[model samples]
Target: MTRLLFAALLAAIPLTAPAAPSDPYPSTYAPVPSPPVLIRNATVLTGSGERLDNADVLMQDGKIAAVGAGLTAPANAQVIDGTGRWVTPGIIDVHSHLGVYPSPGVNAHNDGNEMTSPTTPEVWAEHSITPQDPGFGTALAGGVTTMQLLPGSANLIGGRGVTVRNVYANTYQGMKFPGAPWGVKMACGENPKRVYGGKGSAPSTRMGNVAGYRADFIAAQDYMRAWDKYNAGDKKGDPPSRDLAKETLMGVLKGEILVHIHCYRADEMAIMLDLAKEFGFRISAFHHGVEAYKIADRLAAEGVCGALWADWWGFKMESLDGIQENIALVDRPEKGCAIVHSDSSEGIQRLNQEAAKVMGNARRVNIDIPPERAIRWLTQNPARALGIGDRTGTLAPGKMADVVLWNGTPFSVYAKAEKVFMDGALMYDRGDKSRQPVSDFMLGQEAAP
Candidate 1:
């Protein structure tokens, strides 16, 4: 009787186990198809100065598999009808402080500068990156797929900066640009001196600034010698205890890292070039080179790229002589050594417009820089500076599918980013106006539609 009662109760209650609690939002995002995606009937800018009209581009497994006209998609491929739009490789910013100085604009959030000392080669910028910063989304909206988040120029040897993908993610490691070489942020002239001098430090003058750099590099050279002896099995005992600062500097000496120096004046830039020669290290690029036009030929001869602002000058003593023809003069046909850059959060959003302004200035000065070449300032040139040229900057087969589709000519004042893709994934699509990636922190805080 008892067995029968138990069996009856079990049968009366639900025999099927209660449905396990699931995520109300089960991973609905579909995986990228293997056969690839086909974008048809669009204008393609190959980043090699080649433009294709009514072109077809295919992306497979996160890479550009094919690009041309009259190409057919695979049977199971996803298709995007690009009736009328301009497609170009994703924009790269060699000098950016996005994650380090993330948005929400708070003093507590500032992480780009380790101003505790005038030389902090021990620090690493990637360690300070806040991947969940809202500014990542803003940069994505502007079609910036990859960027190098650099440490500030507050010190002579600021530290190592890291390059990262502008993917919406929760961890910095998840967004790090795979295999991108780290960069050392070195500064010259006013910034370091001013930062330290005001605080009653050694570098109170320009000469002092140079001395500080020389001293650090000299020490770095000695540090390298120690490491070399240890590595070559010539030195015994303790292996010269690991020094993070010297490790970073040795990376530069070994050519495993790139050097990005920030300077404003022409003479200071020349001094930095000489310093590079003295130290036997390459000067990858000069950031905020407002006076680069004054010695554009020298910069080109040294194989150094100048990152400048379009029409940004006269705000400081060093930039008093700045002119609109800066980009034009540096980008002269015989001396192609100029690139427009945006160090400001707002300016970064419209790098295309900044390049356009430089183009306009160049045209006015009778310098016939083609629109394609000017576009290089925001795309190809920066990729070269950041050392990711072969990967994401160009729309070539076997390259990552970092592409941007514009509503109009990217140079136009009214042009806007219509769609953006990173690694064959549709990260931003204005066509789907309803779907936008917002951080968890912004979920209910933002006003609803």
Candidate 2:
């Protein structure tokens, strides 16, 4: 029966549609403009372990043109007085379900999880995202300039995740982070078993969960072979047509997409690692890896990042053994694998505080995680995980002007996002608190302010 269903789905894909012409210069390719803005007299945390106190950052044509002290602002350039403020690259949440599970706190807006089946490789999170869902404003207020909105882990192969800029736009396309590759949200252990078994599906157990993933990946492998043959102009007989679902999976096989697995247990993490080895693709990061410390060395050797909560644990059976030292342990200098992630709306707003807490706890145990290295958990590391490092992760020359200025020590709980700039444009300024984005749904509501 499952084979018949799979064959039916495969047959539904169109085999002979004319291919669209590719653009030589895609929309993301924009010309660099002269200096448009300058931020002066600030403490710059470059996300590369370099800090420049009383420094100046020059923005030209939507990129960081230069960074130094005593830099001259171009004539007619917008000068942001960053006196006494700390500037850092905008925060990047590698694991977020903001838009897919968007708010007004309604079940109708909850699109993150497709729990009906254990394998849902066809579903894409972008299509389910509501751009003006008001969460974008909250993320921006928290200095989150770029975030990956992933599908929830209700299935073995949930869906492809979309990376988007935290900007106000009419459509998701406008908010989409150009040139950022999509991610496949895969899961292991309890989530798949629980979600599918509850529905009386084939994957009601751990072994069943593994079987489900293997089956889909095997199908994806065959799907890619068909497409490769078609792309090679071997249309002698009726060529297998394009399947959006299989196309996404094929993208993973071709290394065009990243895999972000949500696994909690160490044994399951090792299993997934072995599975990745067998499948010949890398697992970019382990999201909600509370037990990551147990396998930090292996993860670091594989260059797989561990995206974890600072101190969250004990909310469920799987996360029972989660420790606050997870991040610190994974971040050991010898191991070199850790990223602080906020899987909640509230947590996203205070990611810095989360990192701070992790650092503090690590220090108490004599694990000296410097603030500079800790910042990477929320910045450079995530950007690399999302494949957007070139554009916005650091305040490097030719990178996007996505920057955040804090009112106090970013690691301090008292600190707040004072100003945020994207593409050299001022999007938020707390001093002029009136400029913050208030969603249409939030407008005229009594509790909005």
Candidate 3:
């Protein structure tokens, strides 16, 4: 009777979905896809190094379903006449501080850096992001579909950088780019040494900076070993005491997270590469690499990207060696991964023009660079650095429908983004103000010009 009762209870039990792993922070990005779209008769510059004249691009069910001439769209698809326009993959900025240090930059808005400690991987940039920052609309209007919001360089390890879509949303989680790998904001050279040196901290000098990194990474290695042993059932006890900072470092050592270091001089970057090798971690990119041209070949050989400014330099001692042709020279090397990143809000609105400046400088030096190749610096290269190359950064089948329709050749000085699409949704339309996003902060103010 007891066995029969147990069997009957088991048979009557209800089934439920298995819960997801306990990720302390989770993304809540719910993309709202638009109706199917068909763009025809446009000059298309694919970010992966291809240009098509009078081509057609079809977006269906939130993905690029077709790319070719003479493509047909569904009866309900919105066919946009792209004649006399330029179409390309959406712009992706690998470095930005939009939400962390948002607009109306007041004392209260300064939350980008955790200068209390030199090693602060425990903090997250997402936690400081203010979704209401009117900066999102400007970037969107500039055709920036995605960007990486990073912490300030006032510390040795600032925190984890967050990749977000440039969509105007209510929460940072909604703005986060889905499945993008987290980046650890680490600093080399003057920023960290100067900030801590004055405080009489241990890392008060250049050598001390290296020592600080080694100590933290060593602790991380020990922490990772302890957790591994526990998980393997070799050592039976309470799990290794959780250190939030070490947890993030362990992710870097395991290559699950990318390491983005703020560095300028070639020698410091080279030293950073050595430190990464010693700690068994890989640096994915070097931000503000003003002198990267000096060691461009080595960076290319290691598959590390140089996320550089076009010409802005010489404001600081470390950036003194910066050259106006930094971007072009770095890109001149074989297998070089060069990206034009705007660390300033004003610069973010003109990244296309920034790349154009680089091309013009290259021309003076007699270097041959085309529109298709230069567009890669703004799109595919940044996407690869943020680890989203497979999903977007190119207008091809099976990729996200993130594209821009420009009023003229994107490399031209007077070019402007006529329409910007994310997931096939018309996020920004110059002809229709209603199509552009109006954040809560801009409700009573003048519309974005």
Candidate 4:
């Protein structure tokens, strides 16, 4: 053939066919419809380190329309008198196990882990989530509009975690946060070593745990190379057999999925960061990191967040050195990304109080964190950790109108979320009994929340 004809034929032929799409279990979450609303004369914590007093927030089309002092309300808006009320972006919990380990706490409800293997990245937490969990309702009562449901840390790599809008739905996919990135659950130090050690597995020691992670990533690297070669049409063969675990790990290697590690010790966290460096992947956040205070500067420098508890510690050796001011210390460093996460079902319902504990302790130590700055721990910081920072965390114009109207300052023990809005739709109201969402599991119970 002529040179022009040969080039034309080459262009006409397709390069190669790709494997199946990465996300099989995708989000089906759609925001509830809402009318225009104007909450005026309120103290607003924008979740972006800005506090606006006597200001108004206008929402239209399920987004923040405006936020400022003396803003004119739309003619068709439902104006809420925010006298003496505090407004904030809806609380976002970076770590929660609500749906996976649903309430009623029976062995049958215990589905947060697939401990049969030390590395089971193939299994997703959403597959095991029970959308009827009553804890989600209680969390809404506490102003949690979004949360990440994670698997248990009983292995080296637990599985994929799913971020969900805290909305009532029959299916887990209905609650999945739209466009949220997937997170892989990893554990360092004790949990992995202990769980597998008792059963006499490969990862019986801390070093063994590290080895397990390295071995898996090495396999993931090879798997990634095979797929790359096939996709580039450099090799002439069908695509390599798909390994679900390696697919997830390869997503991490390719920077598609975020990495959330359940690590307590500062040393273990450092080691995990080094491991990520070795494998050329990123560590998004360290969940339940009790020793995060010891290396706050390092975490800040690396742009990794610490999703931590306010005071819970000392239940085990790895978490023994935890302090009441752990969260505060983590937030002390400049550019630090510190988040207050609720690992407990009960704790999820009191995330504001959890943040309050950190603020109170911080004040005692003279490291004052104002309401504007502290709100980020429960809102902006968690949103960023879950890779949804640009969407729902802040009260900026054009962002999702997920908001809470508290009867008092949220940090005060007496404060209560009087009204909660998700996507500008009123999801919960303390005054209206009908607006109080009760899960089907709690419908007939005498002590229903």
lDDT top scorer: 4
lDDT of 1 by residue, 1-449 (tens): 12233223324432222212321111111222234788898888877667888998898887988999988898878888877778888888888888788877799888899999889988988888886677777777888888888999899999998878776555665567766778999988778888999999979899998998888888889999988888788566668877888888888888878999888899999999998889999988998888898999988877788988999888878878888988888865654657777787778888888888888887887877666677677777788888888887888999988888888678889888888877786777766643345654455575657
* Per-model lDDT: 0.79, 0.81, 0.87, 0.89
lDDT computed for candidate 3: 0.87
- What's the distance in Å from true for residue 111, model 3? 0.7
Tens-digit lDDT track of model 2 for 1-449:
12233234324533322212321212121222234888899988898778889999988777888999999888989898888888899999998888787787787897888776678888888888886677778888899988999999888889999888776554566567767788999998787788778877778899998888788888889988877787688567787876766777788878889999999989899999898888788889999988998999988888999989999888888888898889988875754768889988878988999999998998898888776778888898899898888877888999988889898679998989988888776777776645576665565666645
Off by over 4 Å in 4: 1-21, 234-236
Q: Is candidate 2 or candidate 3 better by lDDT?
A: 3
Q: Give the range of the ten consecutive residues with the poorest summed lDDT in model 3.
A: 1-10
Give the TM-scores of the predictions, in the order they appear. Answer: 0.89, 0.90, 0.94, 0.94
Where does model 3 exceed 4 Å of error?
Answer: 1-22, 332-334, 447-449
Q: Pairs clashing in candidate 1? A: none
Clash total of candidate 4? 0
| Backbone clashes, each candidate | 0, 2, 0, 0
lDDT tens digits by residue: candidate 3, 218-317: 9999999989989999668788888999999999999988999999999999999999999999999999999999999899999999999999889999
Model 1 residue runs over 4 Å out of place are 1-35, 234-236, 332-335, 433-435, 447-449
Clash pairs, model 3 backbone: none
Which lDDT value does model 2 have at 153?
88
